[model samples]
Target chain A: MLFSYRIMAIPSKKLAKEDGYTRLKDDFKGYLAGTVFFKNTIIHGYPHIKRIFTLEEGIKRNIKEDGFSVEEKIDGYNVRVAMVGGEVFAFTRAGKIEPYASEKLSFLKEFFKENPGIVVCGEMVGNTPFTPPTDGFDFRFYVFDFMKEKTILPFDEKQKLIKEYNLLQVPFLGKFRKSEEPWKKLREIASFLNKGKSEGMVIKALSGKEAVKYVTPNADIEDIRQNARFVFDMPVGFFNQRVFRSALFLEEFGMDVEEYKKRLGDAFYSSLLEGIKQLKKEGVVREEFRVFVEKEETWNAIYSVLKKSKEIEISDVYKWKEGNRIGVRFSKIYRKTTEKLRRFLSGYAIQD
Target chain B: MLFSYRIMAIPSKKLAKEDGYTRLKDDFKGYLAGTVFFKNTIIHGYPHIKRIFTLEEGIKRNIKEDGFSVEEKIDGYNVRVAMVGGEVFAFTRAGKIEPYASEKLSFLKEFFKENPGIVVCGEMVGNTPFTPPTDGFDFRFYVFDFMKEKTILPFDEKQKLIKEYNLLQVPFLGKFRKSEEPWKKLREIASFLNKGKSEGMVIKALSGKEAVKYVTPNADIEDIRQNARFVFDMPVGFFNQRVFRSALFLEEFGMDVEEYKKRLGDAFYSSLLEGIKQLKKEGVVREEFRVFVEKEETWNAIYSVLKKSKEIEISDVYKWKEGNRIGVRFSKIYRKTTEKLRRFLSGYAIQD
Candidate 1:
């Protein structure tokens, strides 16, 4: 019973439509929504799902000969940027439209407006130290896939669209025949990501049918370190989800769930001690994600989006009107009273 | 004849002092001011200059046997975070104090306040694709060197200081023995950086007396691509300085100045063509840098720093005072009409 016959609840359609996604019926085997299963085929709108293989599993199967392409697996949130009804919108993988106007998003909005009917899927990496630091206060998006309407474009066409839009895309390592040594290529890419302070690379078929990510061990450690620093401050559920995601990532590295859970337990306690000591020291912590609306009047739209997204609740919303722009500072803050979730999550850490 | 007898004017003292630096006469050969030259001993304050060596020259000299260590060379602005008179200050390599309060800088300031007379030198990488993208709107600084007073601490002490301060530091590659193949080691490091989206590595002596940078070809291409996107928008002098610096970087890769200048010329013109095409499309270009002063009154201190730094001129200073924080949006904006620099820089592109 590795494959669970139990069907998980179907995902929210509003969320899926917002993100241009429809959840597959496959057993995801992970808490995170976007985790790709091995040999899982891409369904254009919604279709049958298959069991997904981890990068490790994929390498063992020698599937590269099936004609796969390797691209830099960006360490960020999956976002779909599209022109719906001639209006540009960016939706997170979980189907939440980013309610903020970021410089990069704004640029994309304008680009989509000019070129209607175009839809670009990119990884929006920000609000974490997953990748190397880029120049600018705005989050950067690296487009990987392209679509027109509901159909995914060919790889070459996707490249053309990226160039046409003057937008950055995930770095294409190269194409490899399934007969070629893909594990060696994976090692090469992982080493590259390690040196560049990147997470890893994603290998997809030329047809854009299947893709799997190979994350470097260093990135995993870095992710743990990053989360440990603020785990104590996060909401209990948020923290548990983070730990679960980290464990899932470790599973890809061949660490059994039990071993990772133990490691996470130790890391959590240690980080709690360190976090406590560091927290006592007074220092400014800037909220990573903030929306600067050009006009205060436009904030109503943002507010409505926030109201609809129950999963993402803002702790505070600071609105200030500058000459022609309105700066809306909203941070997802967790209250200290929620420390009770720590005990609950601590119990679930190793069990999962 | 290899050494340029044509003296580049002494670096501006006001700029250096403002940045908390004293110019040294040691022949420092590199594109940027802070690039260390091989075996060019540090001079406390300003002193007689010595001849600096290009990477090729340094390699040719077989300086690897001199107990040199290699560390990740971060692509960012050089900053010195120190405590003077029990107050925290951040100085740029040009000897200009950063005129704004940042979470990272403030954290360092408080760190220095707690540990008086400690100086931490780091690279604040931002505003370019040369480095990997960080997780926030703010730029990240990676500490490389630690000092107590004017004396440079040993490598281990530097590590200890970094750990004690709980700060990020550039990753340290392995040490190279003179007997072992240093060139191979250099290539290994270069390849690592190339894979990871980093510019290069800085090789320094175990004694901390000498250092030089080794940049990868990939980083050079990225730097060129990034600058080309915005070169048309910069002041002619600033643009020339950037081009010259890039040419200097090319020297690290053993590309002769003439060859680099020719390559730069081609890239400059091509980028100009593309930039012009993209520029016509009316889109938003947001200022990447902003200062958030915790208190409204702190704005004056930032204003004073800007006033003192002649090289960094501000176009508009927008101050919005919120509940307890003051957000100041100031940037060095060059006029669109200043595109006159295109011709001027295009001439210098191949000439300088």
Candidate 2:
């Protein structure tokens, strides 16, 4: 008789006092370190969502025939909200305590107070300092999941509980079966989303954890537009993956390829050209975003935490006192891109 | 007393019996290995030429006021043709013995007979088995340099010798001084080349190796179109470099951005869509090119050598005798790209 043993390389803890994970105590921050001992409980990071370029093939392969809910896949940062010992805390993807969420979302405290020890996972979209503006979503949180202990609650239970708490959530498009030509419906949905300049849709199985996301070509192009100013700072995959997916989306949905191609190309060249103009005229390249906050301390703490993690220089917050809130605008200088563009603009030759 | 001396690391020779280098003995082939020994002499590979995005800054920075000659830069495979022991031999960039050149060009023997041990470096363009077909070239050789021992001969000497041998060379655009608005002239030349659908030009200092090359936007787009089929097999830089250069070319030459944006985007999507269509219909992606040869055995030898170096499967040469010559066609199957595309088409999920 022979036996096989599972051979696994278990990762050891990082050296003590090592820096990387973020922590905050300004409002309600969690104790995030090796093993992330927050309120004497372990909160696992969210699983990475799988993405699909085509709807029919991807849905049939990943989802079941029973039913699936199509929800808007918002373009934003992911954050996990939880109430630990009468305090609300938000954790980022890598178990870092994100203070921005706690300061921005006031309902999180009340929502977590009613549902103790439950983690509300959602996206932080719109006029937040973390990312670019997403139309009308101004520092809003939309609940996408409710995790009890280690497992995510079923769709019905989460919906019931979310409704009871009276919290915001991503808009539910519809429920469809795999046999009902779901791809055709999805193509229509994608077209609508593309027209509105929305991101895409996520297909979630009604009962289980099976889920797959499909994005519109406009979403990919928008991603390129945002990062085009400093494309060199990112890996080539950041742009190529988007372009490749856009092509597949266009082909799969039977959309207008020529129109999308023109827009995609313009998204790349236009943003970068504008960036070049800025650098040539002002000797710098940077991102300027506005954040509206009630308290100046909240913005200051956010700025401090941001500056600690970034290599790029952060500008002092430009505060404009409104009626009751202060609108603060700041910039993150992309110095490397600035220096590189200057060299190229000033006749520095490069080999292709 | 203080003294200083240069320290260098000398590369050791490869162990005997090791494999990687190509060897040929059919006819006029050279002994190629870590050290390229041909006809009782050692021949080194050619150096890479420097490239520039804008002619204005590049010419002023790289080329001095002694005046520079601009020649049409051919988009083709580089080959160093040298006659050794009364045998004409062509070596690729990596010192591989190439028999295709010796078979197609009948005057190589006589040209080498006149100047023994001198390597004439040029490009093989149009209707060839290696690269995509360039218009009007028709498998012709264009001499760009004549090297003696190791150093490249001055422009006047190479031109005189090339003329005496009645060999075809690149069209020599008029020479111009750096201070006499050379950039404006280069823009006109670029526009003309772009209109003709030709690659850009090379500016060579009259007496020195101070040369720089600038390509047209159309050339970059053409490159993308040709390789867009098996783009995954190549580095992402292959596309990004072209796109980046095209943008700079547009900005520097003051071309219409919207027109190029449409074309550039189309170049990437159109060819790839064609490849996808072919793959979905035929289950494979490949490149087919034609080569005109005087003998069947010559085509066979060339095919064999190419197959030995490439991992991609090479198709058997198809021959059709035409009057006094043979027209041969073959294809290289891009199995990796084909397999990857098949997986995506079949709904294999991926994370971006």
Candidate 3:
């Protein structure tokens, strides 16, 4: 039975504005109006789990609380396996399939060729020498669920099927008799397995009901610790590309440019760019382009000015940064030349 | 003291992709790269909230269990009043001030003249009745917080100053002695208050800490319920603008559009547009023009085709429905044609 609540009715005037049905429709329209489809939604999904504690925390909590479970935290790629009809397809955390696994796709295709109705979910984990350390990157299969026709198999049954398929299943952490025990075990696991690049553990419910099926804790801390060394060690251009990609991604997701500025803020953006430039200049990040501050600021200032201007113009200051950080320089000579040129061409200048 | 946690320090590769910080040359550059700025942040912010909620179910829980405190839901336009050196400047929710208020700027000039240190936060609740409410509006000066010398006033002191100023505060709903009591009271209050033209309540913490704040349950429910009615009532064009505004707001908050689609789909949008069109035609909404949906399938199809296209254009068959539920053939064709023509000339032409 669907659980429902009876909501108080709203007045006609106020109701018109807050109508969810209409709001939903507008949302779909907005998406359709944009370029990318199913962009971040399919990858990130809604209600994304923000944090997952490290393995140390899990083990600690388990040890402290007798009721906790201590499962082996596997090192592998997070692959969300889904079944569409009789086919089983594995998607990376971001929903893309690995290009190197094209042969595996055929294997999957052949497997589905016989199993026309069943779908099995599992993680694909394997050992490779050149792979990013098992701490961050290890290929392992963690079978989570399965589906058939319109029915999703129970958690236990899904686990059973993983063994039947000979797929690598994530070691099942024993069930905690008490809820509080898990927290302690989580802490222990975080502390124990934290050494030597082992990222952490993800505590998950055997019966996955909620969208946030798993929790990761010390993983983020580890991530921060590992990356802090490079904080001052990346090239300005390289770093700039990363920043630009994020902005473009935001824009691709249909975010307004103004919103980008508000969220990042002037000071923080300034610092981040400066950090990258410093890293590059210090030979930490190898690059040849001279990292200059004045030129960068001028471009930003111009962009800021043009952002709200009625007319859009390609200012001479606009220069391409590594990827898309359009940098423009403003100087006395350039300023005079621009004014003189503007005055000279005022009659012929076209209004945007 | 700052709360610190040990985490695996893996910095996001996307950090370097931010546009604003990519070109800077200092150590601080790109720090704020992907962060949402006030203006740009909103676009990402709303979507981020959506994403967070989808994962954690926090917002849904908050909406259901944390029955919102019913304050006098302000009827006046949303205004953000800021005091700079004791000079109070009022800005619309979008940050623009009312034109008439510009003439009254001198009234607060003396406050700045007298004490250039105190800054007050207030809202012009019932000042301009440009959009007259069917019911009488009550203007209250509800003060939430304050900022002075770049630092916010202490929470307790801020409340005291608000009281001292004799500014009308959004009334506090009683603090529940028991956790369960608040939810019960919420139902009762919702039933009692939702009958009339009252929009709904704005719940706040009685301790004056902005710990958790939300709109009343009644309002949320009303919004959803009315959405169905609005679809059948309002015009499509007017509805589209409202949707666009909401989208713009979300984009300004740096929200991903996909989240919007997942939460609110095409069917809901079309229904709302149709409802608005109907409302306008029936003289319910006084607006002259109405928002119309070109076709039901057009919205859905756009996603399929334009998922990768940077720019897209599409057109579909549309029909207008009046409040009486009578279908009007091409009632808005001329208006639609003009809008499409204008957009086309502006290089936004995609398809029809």
Best by DockQ: 2
**lDDT to native, each model:** 0.49, 0.73, 0.33
CA shift of B8, model 1, Å: 24
Alpha carbon lDDT at B292, candidate 2: 78
lDDT of 2 by residue, B1-352 (tens): 1110001111223212113233221212122232244435556556556787667887787776568888999888888887766767777766676778866664688777767778888898788778766566568788888877656787888789988988889878878887677667777888998888788898888774678888888999998888887877877678777777788777776789999888878887887788788788888888888877788788887888778755477765588987888888888888778887888889878865
Q: State in Å the error of residue A154, model 2.
A: 1.9
- Candidate 2 residue A225 C-alpha distance from true site, Å: 2.5
Could you give the candidate ranking by DockQ, starting with the highest?
Answer: 2, 3, 1
> How many collisions between residues are there in candidate 3?
146
lDDT of 3 by residue, A203-289 (tens): 334443321112222232233223222332323233222222233223223334343333322222233233333333442221111
Lowest summed lDDT across 10 adjacent residues in model 3 chain A is found at A18-27
N/CA/C clash count, model 2: 0
Best by TM-score: 2
Q: Which 10 residues in a row give candidate 2 chain A its minimum summed lDDT? A: A1-10
lDDT of 3 by residue, B1-352 (tens): 2111112121434222222211111112212111221221111100001111010122233333332234545434443443433334444433333332322333545544543544444444432222222325323445544445333454456557656555565554444422454545654554455444354454433333223222232233234334433322323333222222233223223434443433332333232334334433542322221122233343333223323323222223244554533221112122332343233222231211
Q: Work out the TM-score per prediction.
A: 0.37, 0.88, 0.27
DockQ of every predicted complex: 0.01, 0.49, 0.01
Off by over 4 Å in 2: A1-39, A134-137, A179-181, A309-311, B1-39, B134-137, B179-181, B309-311
Model 3's alpha-carbon lDDT is 0.33
